[model samples]
Target: MSASLLAILVTSVLLAAVARRYDLSSLLFLVVAGLTVGLIPGADHISGIELDPDLVLYVLLPPLLWSAGLESSYVSLRENTRSIGLLAIGLPLATTAAVGFVAYRTVPELTLAAAFVLGAIVAPPDAVSASAVGRRLGLPRRTMTLLGGESLLNDATALTAYKVALAAAIGASTSLRAGLETFLVAALAGVLVGFALGKIVVFIRSRLDDPLAESAIGLVAPFLIYLVAEQVEGSGVLAVVVAALIAGQRHSTAGYAARLQDRAVWKAVQLVLESFAFLMIGLQLPAAVEGLKGTSAALIVTSALAVFATVIAVRLAWVYAFAYLPRLVPRIRSTEPPPVPGQVFVVSWAGMRGVVSLAAAFGVPLTTLSGQLFPGRPQLIFLTFVVVVGTLLLHGLTLPWLIRRLDGLGDQQRADLLAAAAAQDRAAQAAADRLDELLSDASTDVDARAADVLRAWNQRRRQTAWERIDDEGVESPMATFRELRLEMLAAERRAFLADRDLGRIDDEVLRAMLYGLDLEEAVLNRG
Candidate 1:
């Protein structure tokens, strides 16, 4: 299992690297690699690399969810509330009902409850996949925001739906009213858990000054929220998301270096996890399909087609209606950002189901409490794999092209740059103010040098921001200086590499010098 796990990781990295050169997302490639590798000769004997439902739900999900929540901007969430709410809540409900009906109609083997189980299993669009692919393609910021916010919240909704549907499948009596109440309780409890944890964590973080220790806290934070929420009968996923948002909003108060380091660490973690996840999806294909014993291949395949088309069609209709309907409402139209043509198409088509769907499918109980076989566990799993793979391939491969065809980045770049420039100006002013405050009473000897360095850094920051705003129609004096400065820095880097190569300088010493140079260049070339 260890060796196979290692193989999955290595293959994921290789495929991800290859994916960078193309239009496909790394997730897409990794899933493909997983499927291909797991089907190769000896796969049955050699590879135990597959999704462990419990591990993914409890251990893996928290970090992934928290990292996303922390990275997401609360301000953006509010700005895009209407669209996100509709898609996150409304779309999932619509998809579930539509898919459930289709499955019940097309697949006679599945009871209504079992059919709804399949619906809930595939309902939520995977948040991680949306963030990964949508960001990579540089989807419109508002579009990505709506998509991202939708992904983060939809899991809890879909899972709540899944739980209610699952209980029925397992012979536990249930009702829509009970399901709705349970969903509300779980969601509310999850939020409370997250808020309480966020406060406690912030207090602890304020007292701990060590950057490494602080980062370690970040690593542990999501799981704490998740477990606590579940223990209290709440939605663990929602708890993690809320906790992350709360902690993340306050994270700016921590030391800048600590925050930066934490960000980098999470980036690496998400990459590894995302890669492993999609690969696991692929690895599970055989197991997913193996349940076809005694089930007609044609019927199941046809059923897969019906489920896929229904998922796609429902998303398209729901998103378009949601996007357009608000325009007729005077109040909503006044507050909402006007829809950009084709943006809805991008968001609708970006609905590539991924890890969460598979997790839900795998999580379905194998047998009821009476010990009779579950009505449709195997088919549920098989159809899930089909939907995940189907949407991922179809959307992941085509989204970039569709985006380009639509000229999707229109006006978004200018809006982004303006927002960024304004932010840069504020950050520079803040740093300048801080430098003065620190050097105000510094020991006399260090004050002059400190002032000079700080002044230079502040000027670079201020000037760069201004350049973006009020272009000169010709090179700014700062631009000329930056070009020359980069030339010198590059020369210094080359010299450092040569010194290491000549054996005159130890590699360690060479790296130390290069690190200083890198810092200097970064300041001079601030963008």
Candidate 2:
């Protein structure tokens, strides 16, 4: 394999192993690993070391955002629309202005317009990082929904504002009419592309029965939507977000086989892609730092501190202000829980810049319209990198502790209530055992066997419940059983490999058998 592909494969597996062993986030490990490798002598000179900003922005970010969007539930987002809107749109703009004002005042050489442009580039929190950490930390469902939804919308807003600011910096007047028209066109085109792609994917899914092939198709859908939208001058991020939402909604309603295939494929793809993207982020650090060699450390520090504080303070202010707006409206107020101060704080703290910011910072033109070298281009990129690293490390590391300190830990009473409800459902199955037995007798042999299995399961389940009630505890024996099963599976896999090597089984047969074993292992682990 080529070096780039090989590096990706090796780094992905290593990151996974590291994440599994440590309590750290996988993205953190990947970033560290990439940075470590890049700093090695001669590593930066590798033939495949290209870090094209456009490729990262256009090719990488859309799918990453789309994946988060697809996994998000629209029902929840709709209920939290007020909070999402406040954070995504209002906060980003506020932050841009705040940062612009600070930058213009702090740096005499940089114009107000240029400050806004820089602020816009760094305003949106990274959807990928937030989702990755939020889900793992067991953050409230509403919080996760807000973060994901906000990132999706904020990216487009930030990019739009950046363009406007950049145009103004080049001495071009802002035409309100033209700006509105462009925004509408971009939004319309993205929606059209998304719906069109969604329909085509749905059609293909309906026609295809093979799980593997269908899963492969689903993997390509996000990239396809993003690229097509970009080509048409629409918002690629919006297109991917819309396409993913449509695809996910359709998948939920799809037949069992298609849904199963989609779940398996998406789970695998998400793991691989998330790991690779974060690793690349880490690896790019050396180049980013090198670009800043001649810049004064004081200047870089001042800019980083100013931009970071501006982004954070503005988000906090906006979220606090508008989180209660739904209540004022009366009608929408009753639909969802009013976000408390704590929830608003969580939303504000999650605004950690990542791949998109890096891409946008690097994507700034090398030269201005007047052919002057984009002033402070290297310094801007370097400072942006500093902000990304600082926010991700500082907030990402402290967030869990902060949540706990704020008493935002998962609610034990709610968990117990859910568990009790599940136990009651099991009890109901236990009560229906006799009825099931009678029904099974009148059915076919397969039904009879299935019924017998369920009856035994019901009996065991009831016994466990009684034991739990009597002893006030229930021990999980499934863990021991799983370990034993895994050992047996490993032995069987080894035996099969030996057979294939000895010419006792064909390659196709061995592959099929291995695939079955792997699927069984996954199911067992889940159980």
Candidate 3:
């Protein structure tokens, strides 16, 4: 198992490289690679890499959710609350009902309760896939925000519904009223837990000096919050998302070192977990198919097609209906303009199912309370794998093309530059004012040359920002300055390397110098 796990990691890395080189979605490629590897001879060990349901739910989910939440903007989330709420809360429930009804009628082996369980499993579209494609294709900021915010909250809704549906499937005898009560209690508890934890963590980290210690706490936070939420019968997904948003909003208060280190750490963690997840999806294909040996091929194909089509069709209907319906109200119409049809279409098609769906399916108990095999457990898992793979391939591959075909779509580059320039100009003015005040202090010994140099650099920073906003193709003066500066920095870097090679400077000294140069280059590149 260890050797197989290692092999999985290595293959994931290579696939990641391929993804970067080709500028394609890693999720798409990794799953295909997993399927290819699993089908090949002498690679049975790869298939033996069992995806532990608990690991996916407990170990994998928390950090991924936290990282996502941490990066999400609270302000944007609040601004798009109505849209996100619809997609996150309303769409999932609607999808559950739509798919449940379809699955129950279409699949012979699945009971009504079991059919609902499958509904809950595949309802929430994975935000990671949507966000990845959106970013690569430069989707509008508002569109990105809607996709991200919905992803953060939808899991809570779907998972809560899954619990209710699963309990009924296992003969626990639950009612609609009881399910509603459970959801309310879980959601309320999760928010309280998240708020308390977020406040406590922020306070503690503020007092801490060590970046490593702060980062370690960040690494532990999601798991700790998740376990606590579950222990209280709360929604762990909601708790993690809320806490992350809280922490992210206050991220600027942290020391520079902690911010830098935490950013790199989370990126690495996201990469590894996402790779493992998508790969496992494809690797499990053979097993999912193997479980259906005795089932009629026609039934399997029909059931898969029915469920997959229902998932897609329902989302399209939901997104389009809600996009225009609320605006029919006079008050709503006055406040918000009608959404562009293209953006609505993109959002609708972006409903790609991911690892969470598969994990939830795998989590369905094998037997009922009466010790009988859970109705259609094997068939349910098979359908889930089909939906997951189907949505990913179908949506993930076409989303970029769909986005590009929309004329003038997401053309916000110039607006972004203008906004950035305005902010930079104001900040530079404030810095110059502070410098003048410091220089005027009678008690301080301020050098005249140093003050002039500082003023010049501050002025240059302000100029660089405005210059970047220029529509003209010709290079500005600051651009020439940057080019010359980079050349000098490159030469300096080569000199340091030569000194180290000649034993004239210690490696530690060389590293220190290179670090300084790196920071300078980073600033220059930003300009």
lDDT of each: 0.83, 0.72, 0.90
Query: Across residues 143-262, which tens digit of lDDT does each residue of candidate 2 receive?
Result: 778888987888877777777777766667876676667666777888789888877887887687787777778777888888898789787777887777777777776777767666
TM-scores of the models, in the given order? Answer: 0.89, 0.83, 0.96
Candidate 3 residue pairs in backbone clash: none
Error of 2 at 295 (Å): 4.8
Instruction: For residues 85-171, write the lDDT of model 3, one tens digit per residue.
Output: 999999999999989999999889999999999999999999798898777677888889999998899999999999999999999
Clashes of each: 0, 0, 0
Q: Candidate 2: RMSD over Cα atoms?
A: 4.4
Segments of candidate 2 deviating more than 4 angstroms = 1-13, 34-50, 171-173, 255-261, 286-296, 325-335, 412-450, 457-473, 476-521
Question: What digit string (tens of lDDT, one per residue) describes model 1 on residues 1-527?
Answer: 67777777777767776877775578877877777876797778434344678778886678888888888999999877777889888888888889999999988879999999999989998856665655655677888888889888998899999999999889998898998999899999998998899888888887998989889998988887798999999999888888888888888777877887898899888877877788788888778877789988789879999999999999998988878987999998897677877787888788989888988888888899789999878888889989999988888778777887885456555566788888888998899887777777556345577689879978877777767656557788778888898999999899889989999899899989988897788777655
Name the candidate that leads on lDDT: 3
Clashing pairs in 2: none
Better of 2 and 3 by lDDT: 3
lDDT of 3 at 360: 91
